[model samples]
Target chain A: MTAVRPFRPRSGFHADQRAGRLFAAYLVSLLLHGLLLFALAGGWPGHAARSDKPPVYYVDLVHKPVLDPQAGRPEPRTPDTPVPAPPEKAPVRAAVPAGPAAAGSTDRRVAAALEKLRDERALQEKFAAMRQAQAVPKETPVGLSDARGTEAGVGTLAYVQAAIQQNWALSPYLLADPRKAAGVEAWVRVTYSRNGRLERFSFEMESKDAQFNESIKRALVKSQQLPQPLPERLEEVRVVFNLKAMKDLAGLR
Target chain B: MELITNAGLVVKLVLLILAYFSVTSWAIIIYKTLVIQRATRDSARFLDFFWARRRFDVIAQGLDDFRHSPLAVLFRDVHQELLQNRRAADGGGEGLDADLGEQDRVARVLRRATTSETHRLEKYLAFLATTGSAAPFIGLFGTVWGIMDAFHGIGKSGSASLAVVAPGISEALVATAIGLVAAIPAVIAYNHFVNKVNVLIGEMDNFCQEMLNVVQRLPRSRQER
Candidate 1:
């Protein structure tokens, strides 16, 4: 009998053969992929492909807007003075005809309406109070606390006072004694032309201290001119200089 | 190509992975084609030879010509088991119980051979399956990442115009295109190869039964000798 060979599976040999085929196919596949990539790189869509790069738009940022938000529109104007609110009218009583059945509906409606009117009146009063609170009173400049005259005269006197105060100064050494200078007051009748020039000044009530009087006169002289033209009116005005008031204006205790 | 080159880092990585899948699957596709074609052709020829010869020893000598045939390899293995049984009987081990034992042993050999042949036919198919199922999602991940990056760029630039938004989106979509390119062929090839493998397995089943019938006739022939 012919000798039968030992049984051995050819799995290893078959595996090696399959591996070789796989590698060969890999090489072929790699070539095909390379060719495909080359075609894509060459711009595969013919002339339709966007070969030229997209346009690079440069932008600049600015704090102010470039485009006018209100272009082609009219410029809005604000009124120099606020418009006043319309005056409130008195509430008219709604008439009710006679009878209890009609009176009940009317009475209930009147009560509701009266309640609504009260709420509205209260709101209006509250709003008026708020407006009054918001409204600031006109204040005369400080150091003119006792100056009295017409509106134009007071305005002119205030201007004169301001000019004098700008130049007003007295050294402590000029006072003979601090306690003696305490009650000193000087009254001067100052004259000014309508063109805003201080014409002359004479003391109506002179202080006991001569240096104090001289200082007040010197302040008037150094003023040179009123800061602004006064309105044409009675030309002369009185200015009183009280030591306490002067001290207070100077912020001294 | 410009689109691929200009893609974001994550997108580039996704495209690279998809390219690898595409290339490797193509290689597998080619290799499986060659292997299954040869296997089917050789199995047909081997079966024809087996039926014409009707001689196990002669068939054994000719197994080399049909090495790619899973059926041929199965026959060779069972022929070896039959030879072992014959040698045992010639050495004075033959009895009624021993004959039954030989049949059991032969049956075991038949089962083992069928399993090995089935495994051989189904090899390298899982890679194709994985590529088909996973490649698209991986590409989608890349696309989402790229679009997120684009929106992040828009946030930094403070621009939502089409000029600013279009290029990044275009570059992002390249990943999905590559993914679809990779997955489509793989899925189609996977389905086709699965069908082919099933057909081959069916043939192996039929071949296994035929082999069992031939192996069962062996002991009677030996007893007559």
Candidate 2:
């Protein structure tokens, strides 16, 4: 072959070289941007792969004291149920008569006496009834617990108990948060027959966290028979307890 | 593995193919845009240089510098024809009556040059048209296959729950989305490139007529020489 000649740059060669470099840089930058986009959105598929759960809320029910009917009677009130002072009371009126002064006065006094006696008798009867009602057996019903008992059905309680026993078998990630442990509370309400066997058992209220509520619901569901049957005549029963003990027992904590 | 084994797999495969097509089409679009833009700029520059120069010899030298350009090629062909006619007239060897024949020869040469220039300008455009027209259908085919797979899965699973059906349908729909992704840009690029090519062709036609007019106006002896 002939000897190689030294090369010289042609006109526009530098412009062509610059254009090529710019094009290459553009391509490289586009590639890097696409990769960055992919990196950012790539986790979405995995996130979507996870299962969905429901939300839970706190609820409770408490019994109020019965009111005394006789306390409001229009009579000489006792210290426990005293009448208000004049500033707090409505205006009063004087009596009218239809006979001679002596006879009318006597008759008005008798009517007042009878009215007072009637009011006293009514108050005594109300107190006696309230006393009798209070005398009734006040026992917690079997399979009955706190506010959760009203919210959840008997089947839901059994389900919760079973789930708790199974260590919340649905997913390991369900109770991974420690905050959820404190939130998991069980409310059991029981309506017992005279023999104390569970007539109706329910999970009244659940934890605000969905996973915790589901676990509680599952636990109650699994424990069909209560530890002991309730006594007869206990019409209703309720119990509210945090789920931390149950979770610890189940080794889920 | 057969593509039709499951509709979902088929759909995913189709989407993947469509993605490939989209990527390739975008690359082509970018490349073609750059090429067409450069052609337009360079051709405009060459035309301006050709017209601005008063001397035919200077214009011819400039055309030589842009020998790679379609417009330059057209100009060179016209200039050659004009030079041949001038040479023949300067020689005065044969019929002064043959001036009409020389003009006809020049016209033929110009027509041939126009055809060549047009062909060069239209190069690779057919591929772009084909891509634009067919990409959408390809993507749709993928989507249809995917949906069929999703239904088949639902039938096999024996459950028509939203949880089960939604995921499968969503996955299958990805194919159709990819198809649209591939097709939209291709169609847009095709239209844009076609319009550009048409404009360039119009310019070429106008330039050819203008060159012809200038050639025809030359002094007979000067043109021949």
Top-DockQ candidate index? 1
Superposed Cα deviation of residue B216, candidate 1 (Å)? 1.8
Score candidate 2 by TM-score against the native: 0.48
Which ten-residue region of model 2 chain A has the weakest summed lDDT?
A64-73
Against the true structure, whose lDDT is highest?
1
Q: Model 2: residues >4 Å from true position, as ranges?
A: A1-107, A113-253, B1-9, B63-69, B80-109, B220-225
- Assess each model's interface with DockQ, reporting 2 decimals per model: 0.17, 0.02
Residues A83-177, model 2: lDDT tens digits = 32223222234545456857877777868876876776677667765554344345422222222222222323332333235433434454444
Per-chain TM-score of candidate 2, chain B: 0.80
Candidate 1 lDDT by residue in tens digits, A91-152 = 76757586977888888888898788788778877876556433433332222234332221
Give, for candidate 1 chain B, the lowest lDDT window spanning 10 residues. Answer: B216-225
Q: Interface root mean square deviation of every model, in Å?
A: 5.2, 12.0
TM-score of predicted model 1? 0.53
Q: Write the per-residue lDDT of candidate 1 for residues B1-225, one digit (tens) a residue.
A: 788898889999999999999999999898899889988898899989989988777877788888788888777767766666676566755533354665686677767777877777777789999999999999989999999999999999999999999999898888888898999999999999999989988998898887777666665565223
